[model samples]
Target: MRYLKRHRHVGDPLEAALADTALGCGFARPVQHEVLAGMAAQVPEFAGGRKRALAHAVFTMLGADLAHDDFGPDAFDVDALHPWAAVQVTAAKAVLGRAAGKAPLGAGDLALLASTQRQGIVWEGNFFIHLLVLHALADVPGMQATVDEGLGTALMYQRDDGGMPFVTDTDTWSTVTAGLALHATGAPPPVLHRVARHLLRVQHKDGGWSYTDRAQLPDTDCTTVALEFLHQLDPYAYRGPIRRGLDALLAVRGSDGGFPTYGAGTPSEACMTAAAVNALSTQGHLHHGIIQSALHFLVGSQLADGSFPPGWSRSRLHTLFRAHLAGNHSFRTPPPPIRSMHEQTLSLVRAAQRADGGFGQQDGSPSDAISTSYGLIILTGQADPAPAARATRYLLAQLRPHGGTPSPPDMLGPRPFPYDVPVLADAFALLALGHLSRRIRPCRAAVPGRRHSGSRPVETDRAQHHDAGAAHSTENTT
Candidate 1:
């Protein structure tokens, strides 16, 4: 509470929480030191390689440094540069050079330039992309003007309360994710309270939430996250919303007993199902019939390599970790079926580990920060600390000077969309480190009702019956 008074930045409190927890838990290992040393030595190489690659592409395509105007008239030829030349030049010399061009600019050329610049920074059509592009193009002169304009445009999407939506007019998903991340970091009470109120206010009449308040159709993924966040904050206070959300989760169950991301007709997905199980377990719905069926689905869905099929993320590690967490929470006594599933999942994750002590999205892929983080989270509470130790090392190696981690490009959706959000990578790394360190404490201030009890309120028989009925109905229909 005292720390809350001093910090106001959206992510600062969470970062501090993680740092403090890691320090208190003594999560650092000897292996991590060696990894850090090696990474320090490799930093110049990595930075140099990136600089070279970026410079080569930029120079080859644009000719003459956009940073400088040393290139002659031929280099700035609008005809030769046709499409590219149309892009707004930010450097003083480049602007002047373009202005001095004799050929009148065509509308198509201008349009092409505008689109290219937008794509370069805002390709995904999200405000966050604009911020990333601003950081990426910070050194390019004249680009500042474009960045400033883009920033204004991006700001237009911001909600009145200053929270940013992934896109304009949709705040639930982003808010929930940010709140959860902040909660994991031990964010201050007021900040979390604000987030909680927003989520509660946006809860749909059907007892679930979608990606946005505008999208009235409840999805399993967002609803699960919302329920989990509320449960963590104050289960008793939020019992009403929690019950409604649980029912909504049950309503979307596939005939196979697994939960789907969207509506009933949609197929069950590994990630969504895992999320459902975790959320349900959080609220003491672990033994419900629907959960049992979901567990069966998860076991049946495991690939030969021990990985689950990908859903939300391209990284198998993502689904594997989620499923592993689900199993850990869903099973009270570690039944044979769940235990076997856990072993197989752990083996696959361990196998995916690289010699560098990090994990990849899958076997044969290069190790990355996000996947490595997921691996650490999965292995942290297990019997062997070695895998988690190695993963912590791998993560330490990826930390940037500004305290963020950069992961390689990854797939976001069914399409080939590359999700290169560095900030998200940082958040996941912090979460892994927090779990690995075992320093994260429950938020007593945020959820004072359970602060003294330290026990989750039990689910009522009525809730269990409703869940069973929903599960049975889904099975009959499908």
Candidate 2:
């Protein structure tokens, strides 16, 4: 017997043979990647996105035009929609109207609709969303049974505090990000080795890594970070995995030649492409023809104001940071950004700093630890030491024994909603602090147990920051 069918949508150019098949991993991937590889990219726009497409599809199946505000009271001809749309809208609205409340839905009244749920934008199904759909349907007839199955899945990620994360966790991301931070701070070789081992241990058969060990579907961001971490330590040793990951990453570039978060048909994000460029350079692909094309894409993507298209993050600094990373690794005596682009970016970053020496996700927004960290990372290596220095002071004040001050979520999920994974804050802050240690002298308080050995990128006492007190506090707070 096979798993029950979930959906039958494989719109556009074509579909997988299994598009109409029973649910399982088969239906989870609806697109025939090879066939759709030549199709145009679908950017996530507010006016016409996966949500709109899904609505159109549902209407088509219902033999109706999509219901719209344009069809208000007597604006458009309802006669044009006829009995078909009239009947379809009433019936569809009946079920959807029950989906009234917003997410974190405790009542079966609200729904977690998937405009496009192939991912929570980047990764696949997560805990909170499962509960969202489950709770939304629990009061409805016939859906009472799905509550057990859905809650069973959601509760797998339930916290000891009886709470759950939107996504269960970003184990692979947290590991590599935190590991890379700790690595820079001189984390024990054994600890770093274990991280490398875990990544290696859970790598998918297709030669990619996912956001968590439990997941087999991989994305460019996680895979690139994992590759970067492994490459940094021992490129020669991890060469096999690196090659495989590069193959997976390179395999999914859009027709535009930029990388997407996950494989095939997804929009090619500038930040993701930048990351791939950086990671690929570690493999000596900096001058490869593919890299050249990607570099060109990166150059063209930058706006006159010196920004690139935003990535999955809500942080303004995310793309700039990624672009910096990609630019730093290039071989045109360092390629991209050209002189004007670099100057423009530095100007914007400088202008965005708050008087408190912190940076917000956007200019004029409230200062926060994670965004400040991104600022510090961008400013640290610059010719001018001041902005980075001020950012360093800001984070220093905000530093808790746990990591950084609690910050707002900067990651966008399922398109518009935002969520936090907590460790991401810790990891980025630790990383920023490490970069900042370069320009300033550390106080006795900064280094609790260890001393910096006078390095180029001075190591902050992130190890001390995350030690005993932090551990206990996180257990209680998180």
Consecutive 10-residue window with the lowest summed lDDT within model 1: 469-478
Candidate 1 at residue 142, lDDT? 47
What TM-score would candidate 1 get against the native? Answer: 0.56
- Runs of candidate 1 with Cα error greater than 4 angstroms are 1-171, 285-287, 439-478
Error of 1 at 160 (Å): 22
lDDT of 2 by residue, 10-44 (tens): 23122222323222333223343332222212223
Highest-TM-score candidate? 2
Q: Between which residue pairs do clashes occur in model 2?
A: none
What C-alpha lDDT do the candidate models reach, one value each?
Answer: 0.59, 0.59
Candidate 2 C-alpha error for residue 353, in Å:
1.0
lDDT of 1 by residue, 124-182 (tens): 34443344334334434445676677777766666665444443333576667666666
